[model samples]
Target: MTFKKINENEQQNIHDRSCMILVNFNSKELAAIKTVSGFAGIRDRIAVTSKNGNTKIKDILDGNMVDDNEDVWSEKAIIFNNIPTNRVTGFLDGLKKMKIRRPLTAMVTEVSIDWKLNTLIYNLKEERKAIAKGQFVDHK
Candidate 1:
């Protein structure tokens, strides 16, 4: 997996709208995999955006914050957005293997205190495989 820092200046749009970090992945590897899977023309590979401060994964996915339930918290939250479906499934599988609850956006604020700090930012090349089912899972 490869990690390349995006220029802060270039992320003004992302920053202005949300308290999130943005990272881009090389789609070449994903494109190759799609070819093998007979999805060669697929446009998107995978993208991730994380945010600190009180927030939920659902909010991130929906592009806005939602009312928190009694079991949820309002501070020091981590929100992971735009995770690919294959990756999400793999993550749930791994959690099941370790007897961890499937990560839920609603429960994240209640459970993970250092959500932003501990949340993964990037994984490229082989690391992607560790996180997802695709051949070139890159999250290192």
Candidate 2:
């Protein structure tokens, strides 16, 4: 069997091809969201709205986290916002495996969170398998 290598640029392109999903969860679910957000460049994409109506996730992860009450991550919060991609579904499943609630989005009714998240994981696995198969193909 012939083998091939994927270069850095190809890796970047593969990552770029992955899509992003904007997830919003109720304030009471902050800890749950933060725990799952650990997956996509998400621990960083995390953001929360303040009691006074200011958004703070970007600021906090950007090294602005402080002791100020206004900076409280859970202030009478609405919902945390995060943009997680296909790779992030691993953590989503982790929650499901443990029988915990998966973070719900403010969008996409009629479809369940499990269905949406599982679809992303399914597509990603298929893409990876295709790439792997190509890498092992004989090119003579």
Candidate 3:
């Protein structure tokens, strides 16, 4: 098999085509994010509900059909899949510049991809709490 090695920039470009999933955001907040995303050049996005909590991140990332019609905790949050490593700061900055309330943000990871949306949100809340306390590094 003749394999064409991808360069660093090429690999990054492949990963840069990202998708943003919004959870528990109101209409105004959704509009704000969609506007920001437009400026940031992230073309793909979706808003999901708690019912979607059980959907695997991988399925979402793969563009599989999402059935959020099913009834489904977290506050306003955003889950970023396949976002480029370097663009995170700029994206956040875009939100800050627009004076939009910051939502909890997470990038897709190997372990996280298997998690349902609700599971990710709950864990994110816990992690945030841990970081806020002095006991974030519990040795136990």
Q: Which candidate has the highest TM-score of all?
A: 3
Instruction: Order the candidate numbers by TM-score, best to worst.
Output: 3, 2, 1
| TM-scores of all predicted structures | 0.24, 0.29, 0.75
Candidate 2 weakest lDDT stretch, 10 residues = 6-15
Pairs that collide in candidate 3 are: 51-72
Q: Local error of candidate 2 at 100, Å?
A: 1.3
Task: State the lDDT of candidate 2 residue by residue for 1-140, as single tens digits.
Answer: 42222111112221222222333346545566556556434544333333322323333323344333343232121112232324344555655665665433221112212232333233334444566576432211
Instruction: Give candidate 2's whole-model lDDT.
Output: 0.35
After superposing candidate 3 on the true structure, give the runs of residues whose Cα lies further than 4 Å from its correct spot. Answer: 1-17, 63-74, 137-140
| Clash numbers, per candidate | 13, 1, 1
- lDDT: worst 10-residue window of model 3: 1-10
Question: Which predicted model would earn the best lDDT?
Answer: 3
- Tens digits of lDDT, candidate 1, 1-140: 32222211121122122222222223553333334323312233223323222343333433553333233222221122333334434433444555533222211223222333223322122333343663445221
Task: For candidate 1, give the lDDT of residue 19.
Answer: 25
TM-score, structure 2 vs. true = 0.29
Which candidate, 2 or 3, has the higher lDDT? 3
Q: Residue 117 CA error for candidate 1 (Å)?
A: 15
